[model samples]
Target: MRDVKACRVCRSPLPRAGRGRPPAYCSRACQAKAYRRRKNPPVPTPAASRRPGRRRQIAEALWRIAAERGLDAASMREIAAEARVSLRVVQYHFDGKHELLLAALAMLNADNERRARARMATVDVDDPRELLRAILDEFLPVDEQRLLALRVFAAYFARSLVDPELAAVFLHDGQPLEELVATVLTDFGGIPDPRREADLLVSGITGLGMDVVHGRRTLAEVRATIAYHLDRLGGTGKVPGAEAPGTAVV
Candidate 1:
């Protein structure tokens, strides 16, 4: 005798058959119900799908504290408070404050990089001046988001001076940003010494960005300064009567 089978949906015993293939459902209704279930699955709960990780929540709390009150204020207990979690929860996610700080920096850098690329995608990449500007713009406090990032950057830079671990984060890219600037200068800007000009441009923008964060320089003043340097480096490659580089800040 052949072994009996149960319906996949209703668990009813399937009728024994004499043919080569055995049926899965006892009746057409059961088969149809199973098919319907497969076609239209239940939706997942919003919390189940959209919940942020505990580590990220803690890291973001650090970012907010760093931006608003400097990194010194971002103690473990303070971070947990900012995140509305217990201090033990913050400790659970990060081994220590150093690790949490590094994570926040990494996340900030990654987010800025992604946004910079997105911004560049909307522009004409063949225009080297525009491309370079796009890259440099990411470093400046052009808007609220960049403003927060620059604050964190300034705090980290100061701390990195005495802390080897934090300093490593600054040096992680191995001069890649400078190399990219040099490439753009050589290929499109047609500068005589691309590498030298790249170093100057990158450092100049960084200093100017920091100045803005310090409240010593206005955004307009920094743009004018940047425009002056771009003109001097011959990176602007401007034609007669064309608008000046960095004139209208993005």
Candidate 2:
């Protein structure tokens, strides 16, 4: 008599086949699980211990790659090597490169938000000038960390132009950066059209930040330009001899 065979994955009894090749797993679910195990295995020892931090590790690796070598170089194998993990580990954490890209962008947005909040925490919220400065400062590549972040952001922004998935990360319905600046302007209590001014300021600062990142302008020059704009917006209690409202300042 033929001996009963067991499922490879669940070890459950396998139904006898009439005259075909023997079955491996008890069910399709088990079969898929077995395949996944063979494909990804398990993260080993110390790395496995820090499973929670792996996502951030992988995202940060992508950032470094994008910042230094450009985003196109950030393949799964390269990211895994950069993060010092096996490629399977990255695959285990993220479904695919596109999913990973979205995750990394989300992580970056959250990190920047946290940094902005931390910077603002030191200043009194009632002080619109200081609060506004804090918010804009987060955008500038004034230090090494911020510099790396801005560089990575530039890479993501470029890719977002063609990729709808990446573009979705930037497009959102809510109080955008401009609205936040506009709200602060409203508190400052002088600008006629806070929203329009906020829009221009935000756009101008973004352009200036990119300029600094590309070495076209020094940090000092960008900071001076920001200070000049803030002064016009009544940063220091409304500057004397400032251009009149509705007058184009050349």
TM-score per prediction, in order, is 0.70, 0.77
Lowest lDDT block of 10, candidate 1: 42-51
lDDT of 1 by residue, 48-102 (tens): 3223477678777888898888888888988999999887666545668887788
Off by over 4 Å in 1: 1-52, 235-250
RMSD of 2: 7.5
Task: Name the weakest run of 10 consecutive residues (lDDT summed) in model 2.
Answer: 43-52
lDDT of 2 by residue, 147-235 (tens): 88899988988888888867876665665889899999899876778998888888888889989988999989988888877887783
Q: Report every candidate's CA lDDT.
A: 0.77, 0.82
lDDT assessment of candidate 2? 0.82
